[model samples]
Target: MDIHTLDLNFLTDEAIASFVVESSDGPVLVETGPHSTLKNLERGLSDLGYGLEDIKHVLLTHIHFDHAGAAWALAQKGAKVYVHPFGYKHLLAPSKLYNSAKRIYGDQMERLWGLMEGIAEENLISVEDGTEIIVGDATFIGWHTPGHASHHIAWQLGDLVFAGDVAGCKIKQGPVVPPCPPPDINIEDWHASIDRILGLKPSRILLTHFGEVSEVETHFNELKEILQDWAAWMKVPFEQGRDPRDVTPEFQAYANGQLKAKGLSEKEVARYDAANPAWMSVAGLMRYWKKKLGA
Candidate 1:
């Protein structure tokens, strides 16, 4: 039951994935970094005295490319990939996902994410809440905690919960930020998911964006506060008929100022920016607000 943080030198310094529980029954590799980082992942496993074959289970918190893009590679190595039921079909057939991403990323696709292949159905395992999976002697309880994404899952191992993005984004040496990607950013559901994780009384919350955070109580509170503030701020501009594209810069400026006030140095703030493009959140929140208004 060892937890290894694999720092993915992607577009940012704090980008990381947690590989948890290595033993005789074989290690459970959690959250494979994006497809472009396969070499780094292989080297990381080798350095840790474990090869791809040593991994029997690849548990994904979600099907987002940054989080589960490498699941196909791991499945190729015989690892049984487990994910939320909603994301099962996407992994088995990623053509739609890839094409959608391509539309958003355009020419930057390859440079930003590299190639994402489809996972075989034979290696796919769809899980739901309360489903306890036993790898070796350790039991991991899955919780269908959405908000960050509809396909999100949070795994409870012992007293620590591997919170993919339910707890928000906590970049190393930066203000605790939220990754609110578009097409799905429900503030109410996000808060509910936060409460769900807190109720577990986990001693520590492990974030896929970076490292382990033991100040669960304080961390979650701060995350909730900032998330609400961001949402509220976005509402005014949205209701006033401001253009979504025009508001992105304002959002980034606000976020940058907030990060500075939180004691992040210029270099640290750059790290945060690299980890999370602030403008993306602005677009996401705006979209969420528009959807709510329409409903």
Candidate 2:
């Protein structure tokens, strides 16, 4: 089996990535990116000598638009869509998910995500922890790893782990950055989830936000450290009773400084920000602290 990274080219180059695992049985796609990039995904599949219709299985880490938005489209074409059980309802009827994202993105929703159509129930496979998903001769073990999103799962195939966001985001020439999107960011759960990933002892991690990461132990260590730092940074603002918007600039500045110290150019910082917004991390971590304090 060979894994290929399909650059979704969302907003910028190398910002978002989806993986295509080529197997003798058929081609399997992991992460559909956003529906807006379906054309790019099709083109990528074509490059691999496969077509959209040739994709027999579609495995998703989560149902976030950027990750699994195109699963419905593929499912419509007879591809089976596998997702975390908690996310099954949303994919079955994505109105709530679509509407919720609309509130966040406003006018840019459709342009950014295209539109999320519902995946038929027959085509939807709700997976749980320890679920083994077999794609032809290839075998993938799905483990429920939350904190990024309750519906998140990290798929393990041989030595490779499709870590989704549990392993954090690492763009080229930058350090690992935690992706703390809102409504489901739990620091405790995230730590435990990271431990779960470490237990796997994977040689390579495939991130949906970007591409492959080979420094397994170092990557996990950095992700844990940054997760702590970001959470701690948000705790201060939360203790002062400051709104997330009020501290976003400060957090962004701090993060920018840290990234600069690591030798990332301004353009690289901007590209990283484009893939994973700093503001969302602030809000998500603030919410996590509030929940921890029983507020």
Top candidate when judged by lDDT against the true structure = 2
Question: Could you tell me which 10 consecutive residues in candidate 1 have the lowest summed lDDT?
Answer: 15-24
Compose the digit string of candidate 1's lDDT tens values, residues 1-295: 6778887777656686756577558778888888888788888888888888778898899988888988898899899999999999999999998899999899998877778778888899999888999987778899999888888899999998999988777887555788988878889888999999999999998898878899999998999999999999999988988887888878888888889988988877777776777777877888889989962
Per-candidate TM equals 0.96, 0.98
**What is the C-alpha local distance difference test score of candidate 1?**
0.85
The TM-score of predicted model 2 comes to 0.98
Cα deviation at 52, candidate 1, in Å, is 1.6
Deviation from native of the Cα of residue 70 in model 1, angstroms: 0.7
Whole-model lDDT values for every prediction: 0.85, 0.89
RMSD of 2: 1.0
TM-score of 1: 0.96
